[model samples]
Target chain A: MSRQPRASGYFRTSYQADRALVATRLERAMLVLFVVLLLAFPLFASAFLLDLACQVFLASIGALSLMLLTGYAGQISLGHAGLLAAGAYSVGILFREVNAPFWITLPVAALVGALLGLMFGLPSLRLRGLYLAVSTLALHFVVVHAGAEYETRRGYSTGVIIDPPQIAGLAISDPRAWYVILLAAAAGTLLLCLNLLRSRTGRAFGAINTHETVAAALGIDVARGKLLAFVVSSSLTSLAGALFAYYRGFVSVEAFSLFLTIQYAAMIIIGGLGSLLGALLGAFFVTIFPYLIEWALAALPGAQRRASEFFAVNYAAFGAVMILFLVFEPAGLVGIWRRVQSYFLLWPFRHRPLTGARK
Target chain B: MADLELRRLCLRFGGLSVLEDVSFAVNAGELFALIGPNGAGKTSVLNCVSGLYHGEGAILFRDVEIGGYRPHAVARLGIARTFQHGELFAQMSVLDNLLTGRHARIRTNALAEMFGLPGVRREEARHREAVERIIEFVELERYRHAPVAGLAFGTQKIVGFARALALEPTLIMLDEPSAGLNRDEREDLARFILRIKHELGITMIWIEHDMQMVSDLADRIHVLDYGRTLAEGPAAAVLRDERVIAAYLGRAHARPAAGAAGGGAPGGR
Candidate 1:
């Protein structure tokens, strides 16, 4: 593999260097600093802000899985919320029925997700593009309806209440503890996704995503690759869902709606398709955006008068922002980040040479 | 035994027959050229052999029936192919593109890959070394890290060829390797194909449009006309066959001495 010489004078002398997740000492230091900041944030943050950070981490897990399926694998799904619901319901049912512990429920939720992923991925073998999306959408309704049926049958019309998960006699109810747990989960998910993307399986997904025919010709099992993407993504989504259940202390069909699915879709699309960092950034943006909008509305002159219409205004504003992103920045927030990075990276020069003849 | 053999291969799309009762055998370490006019089903033959199409016939590789196996299965049996349009993973880097060809060779499981286990990293390093050999062979070292989408068409074509070589396949199928290449690139391709046949001792089934290049490189020529075989024999004789000229070649073009010498190198096998 080849690379343009960096201004930092970092050169890889071995294949391992080329394959490293963090190639340079500066990057390694920056990653460590970033991790330190994330870990220390809970010590100083207020309860509200800490909760918001937890929400971002939860959304990030969901967004990253969605990005893996729809972004990298090119398998469209409108059933993300349904998959999330499946996870939540799995946790709720297992805990209520069998009094399953934290460790047991999470894996069960993931297994349930994998099974449902295979079922959802079946139609993908025979359909593509809009048709595949429609099938997933239909499956989403089925899943949500199943959850609703459980709620009604169990006579818990409101929702299934979940106790906070515990590990080694310590309850994860504290905001700071939840923060650490979710942070670790999110980081683990990120690492897992990164590992998958760098290997042979990931390459097969990318190949099939680009062109199934060519991928098949190149000896990639396109059908198996598609199924694998679904299974992995669904299991991850389900895990996030189970985490959401424990974190919120409830599971309700109302929580997993068509709009929730769209929000997840928007995260990947507005984050930039096929990028893990974009997924995280998109998650952060979408999670914090409501608060930003609310703060803006509160600062307005007629805020008290328009309080009842807040939800409607927020929905409309979200749509408008998504449209703006799709139109002006189709590459998502990651595109903006790259431009800023390049600006600093190429300081004193406005543009790269046409032929990439860096001297 | 022939490295690859097709017996009475037939392919149909609805009512239209794309290939009709075509059969050919490529011997071990021999470069067998499949040529014809447009829509002569030259590419189709490669497709059927590579398992992209399920043709009604017997396709044996090293005496093993491989007709109905999936593409990946056939590739696991040590067959590799390049498409007419390169068909490289457009968004992936050239290194990744080549690495995908190593898919069938990858021994690590999904769990290992997801965990980035030490074994996976070591396996990846080993495969990268193999892929690097291919890049060196094709002289694509400069473009190794660049994304395939940004490369010139000629370079992408070569990358496609290099990817097939990375498979370390016993039989490599090249579909129109010289189709869109400029003269220099074509020469480079011809040289590479020759080296593959002579140095690596790999058998090849090459679908070509350039008669000069085909005559120069192919040890045996198989000509098709409207989905049927018109001539199948030694390159010089087949090129001179009257029916072959009438159906495809149309006229007698002088065979250059350089090509004849290059073509002669494979006969020793």
Candidate 2:
């Protein structure tokens, strides 16, 4: 009798069962064990390893935001760096001009990002695909140039110095403190995104992404949904941008380049298009990737003579790895993870019964 | 009073007129058929009614003027339509596609829904039950979780129809539901359409080329040619209208009209 229900794995028999995110006991145990590992990391990790983990956490915020916009909402954007720059600059300008605190500057930056997102998203109502991307790219240049213009006019040609953000009685300059703080922020963002993807908002995004006309016919406001995607994604990205500014204790137009935007985009794509876990996995992959390449290059023969070419070699290796992923694993890391997970989960039973497909 | 009415509806795409002064009324609980050869603006009429096109003149759904409403606004007023080519979410499972039809009715906010709060969970389960009923109604049990994109063309149409039904629409507009269907599928579609009309008392505005099914099911027929209405009346009368006959076959290659052409009810009630 229960064969039809569980067909292959666990079956959802009630509303709660179907709605549960971590349905299985095994999944819950794995999650608890993972949390334990995350908590214990700071105790044993090397300084370099700790810093890399922090960077990956920070990148996950931007990556998740982009995945929400481009992946779920199906809007192409090439202006992500511009939004981040706009955020960082808002902090730079506010702190320099009015001596604003972190509390004041973060919201201001988010507002700037929202306004920029609106500006970036305007072309989307009329343009799609490459044209939309091109317009965003143009706007990115406009935003970056504005930041550069400010730097020159203010005579801070190199960059603007920012004091490490402090609470009423605490200076959070320790890498461990920063790591803990960033971990919370990244976790909060993940929770928020997971909330969005499961709700009516996610459905609207999915609808508009899949087929705008049909979504509209179903009573979804497609234009509004598209704009909201840009606004929300950009705001989160800007918040991350502001945090990055504070973390480095400096704000420079150079840091928010097109390359930074490409790295974030690569995180989402090489991670997986539509999964949040893919965003995190992608951040880890892309963040560690360059170091991995550098390590390999050093281990190879003639390493001493070619030390100057390490940066160049890193770029070539990164590009080659990206192309390999694109050609061979276009579904990104999550797809590979899923295939492996299924292989083990359904061991000895190669194919799922037709009715046993994932919901 | 009609469930839906189009009064002097005119639609133009820049220089070309798609629908010109096309007026028709569909009575509540009636299966009204709109028939014409290619380019008769049959789909345009559906588009106008669904608010995809902002045509000049008025579209009243349940006595409210909806001509200026956006697509979603019109949908909120309980009018649902299937596309000429199935416009299903290609990436979503058939179940998700149908659940989207209930978007306006799903009552949970983002936080509660994401956390799987009890109220939202209950609502989702209830709607899923409703969707499953329609799934069974359409006999799509086998393809329940299949993405609609890779399904056979005819099966896609069934998914489209089922999605439209999941709306609990006041009136459902079907565009070429029988077009790509095999004979058996077409027969099944006809039976479903009729059962919905009689049992559910839902209105239908059908655009179909399958004469046998249309003639058998339609209570009233409206014919169009070159974007203008040729005739509108009970099915048998409209089928025999001389202009309707000429519109199907140009005057240069015309045959004898329907009366001498030997179909029953020619020029009759």
Who wins the lDDT comparison? 1
Each prediction's whole-model lDDT (CA): 0.88, 0.83
> What is the TM-score of model 2 when looking only at chain B?
0.91
Candidate 1 A-chain TM-score: 0.96
Q: Poorest 10 consecutive residues of model 2 chain B by lDDT?
A: B260-269
DockQ, candidate 1, comes to 0.47
Among incorrect, acceptable, medium and high, the docking class of model 2 is acceptable
Estimate how well candidate 2 is docked, as a DockQ score: 0.40
Q: Tell me how far the alpha carbon of residue B127 in candidate 1 is from the true structure, in angstroms, after superposition.
A: 0.7
* Alpha-carbon runs more than 4 Å astray in model 1: A1-8, A353-359, B252-269
The alpha-carbon deviation from the true structure for residue B39 of candidate 2, after best TM-score superposition, in angstroms, is 2.2
Give the CA lDDT, 0 to 100, for residue B165 in model 2.
90
Where does candidate 2 clash, by residue pair?
A219-B72
